[model samples]
Target chain A: MALEQGDELPELSVTPDKYLTVRYAGASGDYNPIHIDEEFAKAVGLPSRILHGLYGMALVARAATEAGGGPASLARLGVQFRGMGLPEQEITVSGTVADAGEAVTTVHLEARQGENAIIREGVAELRR
Target chain B: MALSTDAVGTSYPPVLYAVGREKVREYALAVGETDPLHLDHEAARAAGYADLVAPPMFTVVYSAPAIGPALFDPVVGIDFARMVHGGQAFSWGPLVVAGDEVTTTVTVKSIEEKKGLGFFVFESVSANQEGHTVCVGTWTNIVRGL
Candidate 1:
């Protein structure tokens, strides 16, 4: 089903774990130890090996894009990383269309771990 | 060791990074962004974009790479590898379409040290081949004492 304006997607969840961390590092060439190795992360004062903010944003974007339509549909995808998403908490991603025109659609996205949003004020623009 | 506030005015010249369709697609895939505008050139043209435009944040990776040397320069005092990416913000100007040759200039905005914690901000402005500003981003990194 094509997502129209004011549409909200079903809940999708992701957990930040070691395997996902490795894939993110390999894919993006961002091998910051704070994201992959716990000992190194602790040495630097992080609570634990944490998920890359972009990785979480990717999950949210994936849902928004899929729901909106397909690859050639999006015109813009923007997100601001708010709080750290940890391995222990499972984050749920969802979106609502903010506006729509004849051939264009805008989506508002958010990823929450429990009630707290780790990503805030995300938007995706898609062409219909 | 802490970041030098004096580093604020340093400017890093632009570097060429050929944007690959696969990279854009992979990034789109990784983020679960299936926007056809990012994957199909024809679809992008139909939508009024020249070619496959990327996710709004994609260019940051290329431009941020331009600051790699400054972030690691020993004289800069901060250990780039050990630092954490505290945050990032972007203000979009003109749209960044695919196949556009772009130049990015990076400058350090400020450095602050307090209570044994050091924070630094770096900003980059990316322009199209025609010198249109595509986006401006500020990245904050926080470092802890070793």
Candidate 2:
């Protein structure tokens, strides 16, 4: 089913812990220490071990692609990371149609972590 | 030593990056993007692109390392371990296909200090083998403790 203007995507959640951190490392080849070790993160002044920024963005991208119809349908996608996402905290990816037509639709996307928002804004363009 | 804000607008010497098909394929697969336009040059030409265009976001991985010397310049006093990504944006003109050799130039755009925290904006431009401007990327990093 293709998402239309004003259609809300089913909310997706993730609590990225050490295992997920390692998984993302294998998948993305981003070996940034702040994402994997608590000591490393604290040594750098982060509150705790954090998820990779791209991983969080990837979740939002996955949500948009799946909810808007699927992989072969997307056109343009863009995201900006705002705040750091820590481990064991739940991240929620959600979206609503920003605009749509018979052949294509644009969705406003977000990924939020509790009281702190990791990614406040994004746009996903998908086609039917 | 603290970095002097006087460095803004200075462009580093261009670094040549060899575009590898395998890297492009890995990125596309990781992103779950199976667009043939990003993989098969013949298909890409059929679709009207110059060749197998790399994904727009992939430039960051190739060009970011070129800025490391300045980012960690002893005079700069930035601790990569303490740095936090603030934001990033890309403005793409033409597509960068696989098998294209490109030159990348990175520059510091701005730095803002507030309450002992530092926010820095860095920009990178990637040009094609023929020196055509292909994409421009602006990324922000925040450093605490002024």
TM-score for each model: 0.70, 0.70
Estimate the overall C-alpha local distance difference test score of candidate 1: 0.71
- Compose the digit string of candidate 1's lDDT tens values, residues B12-63: 7787656666676666555545568777778888988777777665755557
Q: Tell me the DockQ of each model, to 2 decimals.
A: 0.24, 0.26
Q: Model 2: how far is A10 from its true place, Å?
A: 8.4
lDDT per residue for candidate 2 within B1-146, as digits (tens), equals: 25468766767788887777777676665544555766677887897766566766666656756666557655455666557776665555556777788788888888778667787888888888887887677777888665
Task: State the lDDT at A50 in candidate 2.
Answer: 81
Q: Please state the interface RMSD for every predicted structure, separated by commas.
A: 4.2, 4.5
Query: What's model 2's lDDT at A89?
Result: 81
